[model samples]
Target: MNHSVDIVLPWVDEKEPGWRQRRIEYDQGKEIESTNIRFQCWDNLHLWFRSIEKCMPWINRIFLITCGHVPDFLNLDNPKLRFVRHDEYIPKEYLPTFNSNTIEMNIHRIKDLSENFILFSDDVFPLLPIEEEYYFKDDMVGDEAVENIISTGSFTKGLHEQRYAQVNNMFIINKYFKKREVQKKDWNKWYCEDYGDRLDRTRACVYWYDFPGFYDPHMANAMKKSTLARLWELEPDALDAGSRNKFRGASDVTQYLIRYWQICTGDFVPRRTQGKVFFPTIDTYKDVVDAINNKAYQMISFNENCTPDEFEIMKRDINASLEKLFPERSSFEK
Candidate 1:
């Protein structure tokens, strides 16, 4: 399998009037399942592109997934840029969806998407130069197959829904796979040294008869289109039910299911899956800025769950810091 990797980046312009109106209209009479922070813009998407052009230039194409709006700074003419609206690839029956899982799981239907591609969220940034081999090597996705369990006891009420989705994924994973069987085929792949201290989690869970759960790394995910297709083929009702979720619901299985599937099937190459994650708060503002400026992580995510006031301050300060690192316009921008 040739590893021609493309980047599937899903973005949303929540401030766009028409999209916002539709979102508002959709949310009426329903218990709010998500928050504005999940949809808020950082005014840093151009910087995201700049980081990509500067740090990861070998990408074959960047499919910018959007509901309808595209960033004004994007160079639509760039050969590596491909703007994909939700309706372009997602089936019509699943339209008007605000669920990221629905939009992502259906991405294999994109006619031009490469078989081997990486899924990037709008907020995930590549902080330093990265090689294509970092994402794909020897025709296997570079990822860790760490095992774990979801504990509602540890999560707050705000995060209970996320736990539910992970539990749902495990149900399907356990449906198709047995832990002893998967590990018996290859011990090293399941307990590789690349996982560092994290391998202990797998060892802890190994005593179980089946997969307990998988650690959902917050960084970008590498995947195979065929794997996505295979997952849907094996479990259409599950994927379709997830797609029909207009908002992320408790029953939904996220795109992480595909990654979990890959791990169980041993279709991935074990790699160090460590990456720095920051949830911006007033107390940690300086730390986030320092990490971004210093290039502390190869991959990083700024989980946007801070207070609006805090987010505004962090957004302003962080983008300013990023501007200093990527001072010039990348070919990605006009």
Candidate 2:
């Protein structure tokens, strides 16, 4: 709370009347699933804010970045909440975009945003009590880089929106921090060596093999406003190419670009965690419920490919579990 940090979430309502027409135009003969137009919100805003109220009370403010629509149930009068329209921060040309990568590229434009903040997806929620320091230690971002990757199966062979954006993340990191050999000891040594200093070159703190990896973008992600702004200035062409993506394109870069940038520059702490991850399915649903009941993991996420019906079921079950776990209403709610 003393750090003056805020939470930033990028949300969209696929049910918006104008959104469907815009999606058709942006599809450009490509399937919506393949084009990263599949990002949808199932009205999880209510519970998400509840989790924040129960877990992280020290948060300074919450910025809800949207295309145009705001949830009907949202407490717009709450002084702690701010609604940011895409047209407000992003350029006029990038309007009506379906690409989250493009939107993330321009998040730094949010007016009165704090220098240090945490980015959350509408689907990403806190399962247990978390503190502001969990994201920012001494006002610096908390992150880790991973090198040894297990068999994460292949994504769509062609131009998958998320996978392609990850590749761009690696490209941008390499621009600032050239590849270097990081021994097993380097990871541990970094904790004691320099937690506050900036490295002249890339360090072994972040994980990478053929491509650089961060703590994991699917979970709660901490970021710096200045770092992203600096990245735009330093890599204008890269940012330009990504921002121009009106739809999910192969050239889009992941938000991890800033995480890796901080790690390679020696301005981050390596805090890797194995939280409960529930893929979309009836079975994974049970796993998450058990994880929550047993208090096995402090964090949980439902990230997987699913049918429309399955998505609805998953959202319903997940919300039920969340309501059961944290039954109290948050002040942010009406």
Question: Which has the greatest TM-score?
Answer: 1
The clash count for each model shown is 0, 3
Tens-digit lDDT string for candidate 1 (69-170): 878888899988899999899999988988888899898999888989999997788888887777788888888888887888875543777788898899
Error of 1 at 216 (Å): 1.5
Q: After best superposition, candidate 1 residue 49: deviation in angstroms?
A: 0.5
lDDT against the true structure, each candidate = 0.85, 0.72
Please, what are the lDDT tens digits per residue for candidate 2 over residues 1-334? 3469899988888788787778777776764365342665667678889888877888889999888887887888998999999999998877767778788878898899999888888767677787666688887777655532222356664345666677678767765565453333345634433433322122444444444444354787889999899998898888888788776677777687887777677676666543556666655666766666666676777665667767777767766777787788777777
Q: What are the TM-scores, per candidate, against the unseen true structure?
A: 0.96, 0.85
Candidate 2, residue 217: how far the Cα is off, in Å: 4.8
Point out where model 2 deviates above 4 Å.
31-37, 148-161, 179-217
Which stretches of model 1 miss by more than 4 angstroms?
29-35, 154-158
